[model samples]
Target: MKILKYIKTNVLIYFLIGMFLNSGLSLIKPLLLERLLVIQEDQLTLDMVLSFILYGFCLHLIFYSTMLLANFVSNNLQRHLQLRLKNQLFRKLFLEDAFIDDEKVSIVTQEMELLYDQFFLPLDLIIGKSFILFTTIVFILWQNLWLGLFFVAFSLLRPLPQWLMNSRLNNSGAAFSKNQKNFHLSVGDFFRGADTFYFYGVAREKMSMLEKYNEDYENARWRNEWTNNIVFFFNGPIEFFSQVLPLALGLVMQERGAELTTAGLIAMYIATMNINGPLQSIMYSVSDIQRSGVVRERIFSILEDSSVEYSYHTVDNVSELVLENVSKNIGERILFQNLSLNLSQPSKVLIKGASGTGKSTLLRIIAGKIRPDTGRLYVRTSKGEEFSQFQGNIAYISQHPFFTHGTIRDNLTFGQEFSDKQLLYYLDQVGLTGEIPSILDYHLINNGENISGGQRLRLELVRCLLREKDIVLADEITAALDRENAKRVRQLLSSLPIILVEVAHHIDSEMHYDQMINLKDYR
Candidate 1:
């Protein structure tokens, strides 16, 4: 698995050594107890007593110290695993743009957390406890062969309960995971539309919708817990019986005058408890690991998904964009058919269509966000090299702009270096310099929700200017602006020397355009 690659083998070796020493040292305590119990009261001197106390303290000190370091190592392993998984998920989400939605939000957040808690964390403990259990069994067998063999039989039988319910546990876990994702999706949608519901005085409907989702999530969670409890119920009695059987057999052997001392019998009882402890824990850990399979599959599916195979070619500058016999459809309904357009130089082109004629779809096709159903798009550079794909040299500005949570300067430069003076120049060109007093230092929250819609749109325009894109695909960018601000934006766009393909419902009367394409005619 890819997860194994993140496990630091050198560090893991240290962790394993710690587990071995810790488990081995734990068994030594029972042996020491046996020795102490065998001694009579008259022979126990002060020096012997002090030495026993010192040995006990030092042994525990080392045991706890080893345990602490092992825990730290496990934490480090978890950190490394989560970071790698999240990084891979982030890269895959953007690369596979067609496969994104609200469900992905749940995957990146909740599913990742589940993967750590149920899988990675439990797996570490299981390994350590398994080591301790093995050493305990070995000590028992060395002390008494029949008792050791009897304990091992019970040990093997203990996991049978969990194993029998394995399929049911997995099914309940899967149901819970599905319901969790659905509830998360519903919550996301409710919050996104919160303003609309509040303004329209329909907030009660939102609550009602959430109630249904909450019921499903809670029911699934209850079923999962109930299934796990059944395993626990069966496991409890078996653990008790396993412990009793070893002690009873030791007693029977003692009555028969087998070579067993009182200290040895006492040690046998302690060993039985130790055996039962690890066995019971291992059973639950196995069930936990089984339940985690659903989340593991969800994470691995995204991680192992093959990326779309396409190499993006770059041009220094775009000289022309030509579409021949282009067609697009949504399901069975054709949005546009046999559409053709040619732009051979830097110019403004207006695309106008009725509500369903695919104006925004055409912009997406030109922006390389999606592909047309038929025909080809050729992008030729100034040097006369024609490429069949539009991979670079363009900036797309949609109606709803995208902004990360950061300072205004961070949003504009997008981690690139640019002087404040240059940024202020563009901010002023978009009439935001006077509006934002902090200029570069102004912080934005929740994708600039503190700013007005017009300000967010202007910031997006500034981003395009800073990117120095050769072609700008504007999809109803001015729809949110007032008439005056809209006119200002239109004038600034018209003055630029780069090519602009704008899709708009209304065009200014005095604005100049080199060409216009109407999708209704093409249809």
Candidate 2:
């Protein structure tokens, strides 16, 4: 039902109409064939043969035309569905606190394709084929009620094989999907660790592990395929009986003069053939849909899930921040406790702590990345805006900053509109203009691996400056820089006219700070 929400109502109606027309058109050929078979040799004429040929040609043209139209509708439906689903996936992935696991990643890349192919694409065909089966059955009953009843009974057994093996098919399908994802992850891990393995002289062992994963994936595929084959094996005989038994019985009824004429019996036989394809196709399509249950659920789960939607409290300008008795713990270990600090008047504050002293954790808490266990943080703005915590405004510059593979402008603006002049000005402010040529046009690959560590940190600072964020939380941003670059970064931070909260291992005398809190004293 949720999936149907993406489909346009008018378009769906048009498709169903096309399917019905196509099914109706399909009956014409069978009826024409029956007419041909019933014609006596003595009565056959050139005009009659030519007329039948013309009708067949016309029927085929209309049939294929309707088929083409239905195909276009199905493709368009898939496109619309994919578009909506893609937007949902993109929003979920970019939201704050979005944790992307392997399954979610596979949902975006692999499972989406599987869902379209197995479920969405075939869904229209399933409906269309069901229509064909129903119409064919009705046409047969119109010819002879007893033969139609026999067909209805035999058709009941058509789905038995699928039902009997439904659970196995579902389980195997899920297992195959799981193994496929695992195999992809294993391959990624193997490639990611390839350099390390070579350095450690254990590449062979890692390769062996990758081979094991491959074999497992293959085994799962084989199991899923063979299980389906077993279902098909049972279905084959049922289909044979569905087609052959009806014709044989029709012949017997005609022989016994059971209100069945030769023409009617032959027409019913022709109609039975029509029913066979759609019936078998419907059964297999149902099985295919059932096989896609896991993937379908995985995709729908994300669509239906309520992601953590935070209403950001907007402020004109942040002027103060206060942490009251903030405490954080990792199991039994208290990283820090009873930490209290107040920063006002757009002041500079430095938190000095040794390793394992919750320095980064504290900064993340202020940036609203995580919450403190036992205390609250309050935020105040120059326009008398007050809030219990920061929301959607603070700029966080981590030690290992986030970057995508794009030009410097792309990284800086993040698709936001920023003029070249404004971006270059910020680049000049962060001293990045001197180091890289064509500063804005410089491309970064693999999270700015092409740039130096200091340059990467400086780009992050430039991003904050471009955004004019009122609050900045820098976590050991200059730790990896040399003395000159470190001094440059420290001066840039100290010169910014914003509320700055910096946590670093080393405290420089050259750095100006209105407040300094050693986290150890709070403990």
Candidate 3:
């Protein structure tokens, strides 16, 4: 059922049709050989050979058409499955009460891509090969029962070597994938702190680690290849036996004076050889199927594990957010505890905390990014009614802002339907109007790579202002900026009417908050 979950009905139908055509075509080869051998003693006419050629061509056409259809169906199914899984993942992320862990998300994304490749292709091959194998066996048994038995016995031996190879490959593959992930993580860490590396003059040392990882990856690839080749080598002898056994037995029968036509012997030999084709196909697909099983298990585990749930209570509108007896824990370590706070609209509060005092977690709880383990959050609307939901009223800006590779205007507007004048006004407000040559014509690289960190942060602030949320939860938004830019950003935020809850390490002069709630006081 787990594997079948990925198989859509239309895909199954397409596979069956393809299998039927392939089996029918495979039967033709053996039948044609039998007919040609039967007529070998007679005067082989041009018309007879032409008829045989036409029959073979028709079977080939059927095989080709079915193969194409199977490919089409498999591709479509793969596309749909990828989209469906992505959509589900997006929904899960959106509905969760906290930001998704980036590391976990990365792992899930890679596993999903691998699962899509492994499941659909192998399933198609397995379905088609099974049909061919079944039809070949049945036809051979009907023609000569003893030869069919021999084919079955020899075919049973094929799976052993394949099974051993598949086991070894899968184990090695898992190890390789893990090592590869570690390598990527290490490389990411190096590049993300290029400044540190340059300042410390440790670039060469870091590069050496990358080279070692590459060598390990290459070694793993060769190991997998060598293991598979050994299986193929073992299979070659089994395949040879498949063809030779029928011929040898047939000759013995003929020598013993049992009537065995040349046509019959040839047909039996072809049919025996046909068994290996399907068996080999199955072995190839089984490798992918095993890999897919690992991916499917990973995907299903994410889908099944419960995250934070949305509150059932609804509000007409929310004006104030309140957390009473709130606490949070990651595993057994309490990140925060007994933190009670209330934030009202059109007010500003500064949340000051040490590096690891959970200021960001507190902000997340208020912004509905996280649910406190032992407390209730009440949201009161401007009209004096309360609800348990946070929606359409809060904007959260983290320390590092995300920007799509695009123009300054696009980053500010965030793809929202904004007019030219509105976009320009917001950009100007954030002091980015002069940075770009033209407000309407500015282009930015992805993640704002072409821009400085201060510029990106300013753009993010502008984007948040444009959203016009009632409350803004900003976590170290100005940390990357120089003093001048930080001062400007502080002034701009102070002027906004939204209730601001900011997490800051340093508070400069003349930038006063209505309430400065230090997390250290609570601790």
Please report the candidate that would top TM-score against the real structure: 2
TM-score of candidate 3 on Cα atoms, chains taken together:
0.86
Displacement of residue 106 (Cα, Å) in model 3 is 5.3
> Which candidate, 1 or 3, would have the higher lDDT against the true structure?
1
**Model 2: colliding residue pairs:** none
- Tens digits of per-residue lDDT for model 2 on 380-451? 777876797567678888889989999999999999999999999878877789889998889899989999
Q: Runs in model 2 with CA error above 4 Å?
A: 95-104, 309-314, 388-390, 521-523
Q: The CA-based lDDT of model 1 is what?
A: 0.81
The CA lDDT of each predicted structure is 0.81, 0.80, 0.73
Q: Taking the tens digit of each residue's C-alpha lDDT, what string does model 1 give over 121-173?
A: 77877887888888888888888888778866776577777788889999998
Q: Compared with the true structure, what per-residue lDDT tens digits does model 3 show for residues 385-441?
A: 877766567788876888777776666666679888887787887787888678566
Off by over 4 Å in 1: 5-22, 25-28, 95-101, 199-201, 308-314, 322-325, 338-342, 384-392
Best by lDDT: 1
What pairs collide in candidate 1? none
What is the lDDT, from 0 to 100, of the residue 222 in candidate 1? Answer: 95
Task: Rate residue 416 of model 2 by lDDT.
Answer: 94
